[model samples]
Target: MPLLGLVSEYLGFFALLAAIVLVWKDSPWQKGTKVAATIGAMALLGAVLPAPPEDGAATVTAEADGKAAGGGSAAGVLAPASPTAGTTPEPSPRPRPEAADYRGMTLDDARDRAEAAGFGVDEHDASDEDKSIMMRLNWTVCFQKTGWTSSGTKTIDFGAVKNGAPCPAADGGAIPWPTMPDLVWKTWKTAHQEVAALGTVPGDHIMASTAYLNDQLPDEGEYDDWRVCVTDPAEGGDVTVDLRVTLELTHPDNGCPDPDREDGDRPDLPDRDDDGDPDYRDPFPGDRNRTSAFPNGLTGGSDDSSDGNGGGGGDHWNCPRTRWC
Candidate 1:
């Protein structure tokens, strides 16, 4: 039995004995009366004080109560169990997919495949022109890079060019810059095709001007009938789509003009002074004082007070005196 239970049992018995002794010795009564008083006091004390708990039973009961109150063991220590002790743990998410190669495929096919594999696709021009990919079907993938972004989103990038066009030698490499081709004497249509083959849009980069005098501006619809007479950047000059390239053109029937003559000269205009400049462009066509209408203040042959046409008005034909003429 526990020490506390034994001590309590002994205390109860002692209290009963003290009550008997007081009733017997302190009362001035007959022997029978004293005996009756002592017995009555004993019976009252027994009723008030409960019997001590049995040894083994008391220990077992205490342990059982401690457990019922959430104490861990017979020692009465508190349990440190968690609130979620019996529950199953949640599972982790699946891993992300890996990147794939997309070279040598059509842009449309490559995009579809990348998307199907859970990746976003971005495209770029593989040439120095930096043109946008308009028709996916018309462009083929030259190279590709696939990987995850900082946000963990799968993505792919493709460098591509028009079908049948060659790819750059390395990934993300730009196609070599093209040198201006000698398109002189070629039909406008042929010139346009050659420029396009070099990855340049003829309408955006190539311009045409009339090579003959008194001719109307050339039209794109009749480009097949016009022939190139001169190229702006000249033959073998470095060219790109961003540069403005102009071509001097004339009709096949009219034929090209002399390459050595001044740009705006008219074959019909007379040059009495034998200067390279035509009569209309020369400020002093007869005196040979000035060869062209170029504004270089007047040279020699002072103000003769006569116009080039033998008129009286002093140089009235040199209208505005600017280079526009």
Candidate 2:
């Protein structure tokens, strides 16, 4: 109970005061005084600081058995502690932990992180309903409250659910938009490398969806028509990178809309759900029943995506419908 609350903070100043008086005041044992003061100062800090966090397994077990509520009726989950009679509220002086991405992690993992960051199991929210899905510690973390501003030693609380439970898609990536690179307009090839250089993974922090229009098919003259189009969460502030974004690609001649495009004219309409011919060109315009799929779109083949970086992706697909792969 001595270090459980803030009243013990004054003990530090008191120790400092006594140490200073002992070292600087008139004393026959001046040499011994300073050493003793140093040891005393260290002892005060050691005793006043909170103890290392208890093991996570123990805490979870305690909550499961209904002992962490600290009183009767077996509280459904950890209930906030009430102040003891005659005790003054304490000021927090402990350092907090740096920000972390808890998404896709397990509840037990999230709990361990919170505890290490100077938080107690009772200090944050987690209902028994949330824990009902713990199967070999596989309950997945779905939501978190902290963002880029988090720093060392600060407390961070997150929410979790069963592995298969529905978790809301992150509003954006875990990294802030300012921190993310400008990937728009860059070829699929270069974009893959950029994210990797920044320590992010494709399909994890980025995704690419490929589509080739009639003009993009082999029927047309060989040309570099496939390029990156729109991205989700558009480039902006405070945006957290969710998983990789889907980069829609089309041939330059296919006439996709582009705000950056110089001409103001809208491109011609597509086949409208019609199929392309054996030559890989749109054969049936505006006929949903006869649509065909042609060659697949390109995304810089290899294990790495992007036409520019590795420059060797030429995968094919079968399209008997409105669009090609």
Candidate 3:
């Protein structure tokens, strides 16, 4: 079969050469016609010839055929190729870094540490003051929460306070307690304002009641005309959210009743010095010396006098001795 194939290829080439020579020299055709004939013969010859193999093409094809034949099933069918074979693999995502503690560190230091560990930092005031950390170096971290966000980023939140301040007993426990103020003799509106000034919700913490028995009460909006007669958990008391402050009020028409005196006839007056003498009756109510000088108004001399005891003469009684007197 090899010998026959070689002989047939040689014959085809000789026949093409003979046809070209006959059209150009022996045949009586025009110049253009002869050239066309020669070209057709050359095209036909090229179509019949086998194409040359590319470098390593035959070797690859032969190896593929050999593999298919050897790996075929007993029924002589070749197996399907693997879907992922010879494909470039996809790269995997990088692992997230572990969370770290940032408590007890300076705000600046905590931020730096968190960023270095491939984490984002969120900071806020732990004292519940809503104060901004103007100077990071001057603030210290009191607490921290470290976890991963839904977007796959590791984040750490820090609560901080000014340096030298003690951290709260627990997280989110740094809110300062409000102190109760003196609200007696003040209008209901003024009393509510005072409570609100202490950083408390006045409506939730303050309650009012009529001071006099059988007195009809008005709506809360009319409380501006009412006066406070007494307060629960009186002045200088520490107020908290759970504690309610109750105020005894008196209507504008009915004056405040005296809790200390009976018969409800005694009038309530401002005693600046608390010396039993009301400011209206006391000549020197604001003078500490006059209000606290002698016990029971005895004839004790004034300290400012030359005698040092106001004992210069009779009936002096330490009265009209000082400039205030």
Candidate 4:
């Protein structure tokens, strides 16, 4: 290509020389010399200029199905037959009975109660420590809350999996990610708002259960009674959060969530069969035959759990039977 361009340029110089010879014929300007010089310049340009190499090699690349592993499977590949317009899609699956309390309270239950009281259950946990129950509840909560169930709970051993999508608000409120109601959110909020007001030490300084203790009711009266030692100091550059919650009733009720609590702070106990440690025991004992459900710390009245935020509070249950740090 370069040599071609150079030759084309030198042709112009030859033409110029030819024109001068024609304009001043036999004027001792050496017409033959001019023609020879033009030809030599053209030859030099053609000799020195570069030329493009002929097309030869081609590149090859591997093709994939465009689907990532452990990602969207077959169903994800299919497109809808028609565009959706002026219509609503079918709702997601509601949580199963396994997701509900004995009192028939699912996130839907909480939502109904919240709506009845001019509010809404902002989010819920589709999963908990109980995998069997969680599996069933996952579908149920996902269905009823559809977009909101994604606020579902995450277990302590969260690994490399990308978190599920967040729960959209039923009433368009803020959505909390990674997990939902049941306990952690309520515990943190109560620690920041309610409990800390009583001059108790902040939970940011304690070693506590990261999950909710449902059957184990909250301790009340003084902050000192509920004080648990911080067994695990945070690692280097890690945040130190000590969560201690004491649920005190503004008014006592005989029909409180649980039966054993006649009117006092319930204690937590240990479960030996599950290979769980004494300090880290499951609060709600399904095999233990306990049944009671209360939202927030309210008793005798059907009130939606408002753990500071609109989401249901973690049902509190503490047992001196099993000491939790």
Residue 16 displacement in candidate 4 (angstroms):
17
lDDT of 2 by residue, 182-284 (tens): 6555666666565555432333566555443333333322323355555543554232323455555555444345546576433333555534332234455
Whose TM-score is higher: candidate 1's or candidate 4's? 1
Q: How much lDDT does each candidate structure score?
A: 0.69, 0.50, 0.70, 0.34
Task: Tell me the spans in candidate 2 whose CA falls farther than 4 Å from its real position.
Answer: 1-180, 195-205, 210-225, 237-244, 252-256, 260-325
Please list the Cα RMSD from the true structure of every candidate, rounded to 1 decimal place: 17.9, 32.0, 16.6, 29.0
**TM-scores for candidates 1 onward, in order:** 0.36, 0.29, 0.30, 0.15
Which order, best to worst by lDDT? 3, 1, 2, 4
Model 1: how large is the Cα RMSD against the reference?
17.9
By TM-score, the better pick of 1 and 3 is: 1
* RMSD in Å for model 3: 16.6
Task: Estimate, for each residue in 279-322, the C-alpha lDDT of model 1 and write its tens digit.
Answer: 54466666555555444544433355765565634454454434
Clash count per candidate: 0, 32, 2, 27
lDDT tens digits by residue: candidate 3, 1-325: 2232245767777777777877778899999988888887777677766786786677656666776789843444344555787888786754545667678899999999889888888998888667877889988898887777778888888898776566777766765555678777889889888886765444667788777653435666876868988777777876754567888787665567767776754354466866654454455676544543342343354343354453454445455534524
Q: What is the lDDT of residue 229 in candidate 1?
A: 85
Candidate 1 matches the true fold with a TM-score of: 0.36
How far off is residue 298 in model 2, in Å? Answer: 29
Off by over 4 Å in 4: 1-29, 52-108, 111-325
